[model samples]
Target: MAIKVLVVDDEAAAIDVLKYYIDMTPTLSLLATFTDSRQAIQYCMLHDVDLLLCDIEMPLMNGLEVAEKQLGKTAVIFTTAHTNYAVKAFELNIVDYLVKPISYERFLQAISKYKEQFPTSVDDHFFVKTGTKGHLERINIADIIHVEGARNYVTIYHGTTQTITLLNLKDLEQRLPARDFLRIQKSSIVAIKHISGTKGGSVLLTNGNLVVIGPTYKEQVAKVINSKLIN
Candidate 1:
């Protein structure tokens, strides 16, 4: 069955781009598109939608407000030009926050994240093929410490060993459990349980590796740090 999707954006151009992308994706079916936030909310209330592609700075009712109203009714993927709302968006447990002028590749990555978070069957592990040899290795999700992306490959640090796979950071981020991992920078995703400290825009891992939090990711990273801090 196709995943039902509803798009809400104040800009006609943004909505058009999203609609075009939705049409191209075989797994997603467009239920409706609205320029008005209130109308979008009304439609969602009357229909069953699996995903909501929304914009944050819309007039009348912003995307955050809409997501708040929908709550458990639909999963939200924020499509906006601003990065400021990211902290609040993640607080709502939305699927993904996509910055504006979203590339087709990134849009697809968001869909992959949604599928991973709401899979039909529970998955505790995933496999990654070894470099060149084509041997598939099973990896327990809980054993991962962090993943670091370099050039075209990502190093998965798990247990006492690390495996370098030919996968980008965005793709790897979607595969990991969102609640257990977070993208602190463009090139790094850290396991929440392995974070030892956060200070001066850097995350200290249990292994003593410090990952610098990117400027755009500060708020989202701070939320994680704040939640874990003992007061």
Candidate 2:
């Protein structure tokens, strides 16, 4: 089934641009487009939607407010010109934040990341501790790598640099968003983001790290790879 999507923005031009991209993607279908924030909320409350693309500067209620109200029902992707809202948007657990004049490439990249992290239709986030120095790394649902288990702690590897932290894998797992991270084995949990290629009983990550896919995790690995859904 095509993903049910809603585009909300007071600007008619912005809505048209988003609609163009939505029409290009075969896996996605537009259910409704709203110029008013209140109307969008009403429709969302009444119906079920897979994804929501909303503008932050609406008159009645802002995108952040709408996202808080939606909770976990739909994947929220914010579109706006302001960069200051990046941090705040992260707090809302949004799927992706696109700046104004959003290009087709960037939009597609965001959706690609979204599908990779949310293969089973579950939307969520994850957290990792870098060290005991009162510092914690909170990652978006898509930006995680395999958690390597050490003797007394687990090291979280993400971004360009491999970050190792002083926290046990078990404790970290409990703190992380359950739906987004899946334990492939006792010692390792690979992020849906870093995964690049998969075959047999192993998976290749974007960082060039190859990890073994345990028997129990085979289904999850396959699902993650297939969810990319790109031709």
Indicate which candidate wins on lDDT: 1
TM-score of 2: 0.52
Clashing residue pairs in candidate 1 (N, C-alpha, C atoms within 3 angstroms): none
Q: Residues 99-204, candidate 1: write the lDDT tens digits.
A: 9889876997999999988775436788887875869888787888889999988898888889888876655665665557877877888889999887677998
Show where candidate 2 strays beyond 4 Å. Answer: 121-231
lDDT of 2 by residue, 1-231 (tens): 456799999999999999987754445678999998899999998998989999998898999999998878889999898888999898989989999899866887778777876775333455556656777767654556767787777767766656676676655664444444556666788766566787667878778888887885576557667777697
Judging by TM-score against the true structure, name the best candidate.
1
lDDT (C-alpha, whole model) for all candidates: 0.85, 0.77
Cand. 1 TM to true fold: 0.56
